[model samples]
Target: MKVKIYGEGAEAQELLDKVNNSLEDLGLSDFMEVEVTMDEELKNSLSISKTPALIIEEEAIDFRDTIFEGIVPSDEEVKSMFISIIGGGGESSGGCSSGSCGTCSTGCH
Candidate 1:
């Protein structure tokens, strides 16, 4: 799948790096590609109107909300984020594969 992340600033690089690492760690690196776009007109066309806007496959997965607020997604959210960014092809293990949410309060907590 092809994913594009838009965010112009010092943190832009950092966020991209983290995202890439996450994908790689999950063994999805070989199937995905990430790009950092910095076209102002393109940004406007996407209705981003803000920095740190992400366009994943013609859809705006993330915009200013995450950028300005400095809110990182929960690990599960990040895993599910695969759908928005990538087109999706792998079969999930059903339960949380990351196990990063051992303290999650959804039900097991």
Candidate 2:
């Protein structure tokens, strides 16, 4: 899977960090590639009218989807979105039985 984050400035960087953290927490950092692009032409091509848009692509299935337009999603939301896209069972196996462990809750698992 490929994840692309589009935006500029501090907000973009913060969102990028959140995405990275979430991916790492989910143990998917090694399996996925992430890219951040602020090219206006690229954004135009994607028809993204807002900054901080996240685009996910799965080459094997020729699937391309976009989310988080104009708003930064929470860490859990981002993780869940990716999990759903990859068709994972979405059950975290870490020590967060209540789904609220410190690491998991802070998106730093």
Candidate 3:
């Protein structure tokens, strides 16, 4: 999954915890691979230009503030979102591989 949230501080850490707790409560915690930080090297490597950004498996999620504005995606919601994302032909967005089963792969996102 390789999830990275680009930012650090009490607020950022709090948001990270919220994300973890929310996901875990729904039993979808394993669906995510989370890393919290705002290191310059990490920002550059992840191509992040804004704080509070999220990179999911090499794909840029776009908004930095939006993700941490106290909003989190539900498991089914996340799944549906990625379905559209991958179907649009944008790097699979951590979904299934065509060679593996020709369908969404066990909700790898």
Candidate 4:
């Protein structure tokens, strides 16, 4: 799994720190690769409309999910996202299985 944080500022770096901390806390430091990017092409390809956006991709199956855009998620929120992804076998449990659960509050769709 890989996590990419898109932006070019302290906020982006802070998100990176939070992610690293969360991974360390969850004993998943070696399970994922984390990076912060300010590449315009990458941001455009991901259609990132805001700074400090986060994208989580499971490259094994070419699965890419946008966790958030335009905002900074809390440390716990970031941890929960990782938990959901790991526990659900790459499918985030916070999202609706049938796409009918609507407005999930777990920061995933």
TM-score list, all predictions: 0.55, 0.75, 0.45, 0.79
lDDT of 3 by residue, 3-107 (tens): 566676765665566556645765556866777765787567646555555445534554332222223334444444344433643544443322232343232
Better of 1 and 4 by TM-score: 4
Which residues of candidate 3, in runs, are more than 4 Å off? 45-47, 58-109
lDDT of each prediction vs. the true structure?
0.52, 0.72, 0.49, 0.75
RMSD to truth, every model: 7.4, 6.8, 9.8, 3.8
Q: Candidate 1's residue-wise lDDT over 12-85, tens digit each?
A: 66657666877876778887778888877667666665555444453345332122223334444455555333
Ten consecutive residues with minimal summed lDDT in candidate 1?
Answer: 63-72
C-alpha-based local distance difference test score of model 4: 0.75
User: Candidate 2: lDDT of 29?
Assistant: 96
When sorted by TM-score, best at the front, the candidate numbers are 4, 2, 1, 3
- The TM-score between candidate 1 and the true structure equals 0.55
How well is each residue in 1-109 modelled by candidate 2, as lDDT tens digits? 8888898888788888988998898899999999899878768877898888887778898876665677777777776666655557545543332334333333321
Among these predictions, the greatest TM-score belongs to: 4
Segments of candidate 2 deviating more than 4 angstroms: 90-109
lDDT score, candidate 4, position 60: 82
The pairs that clash in candidate 3 are none
Score candidate 3 by lDDT: 0.49
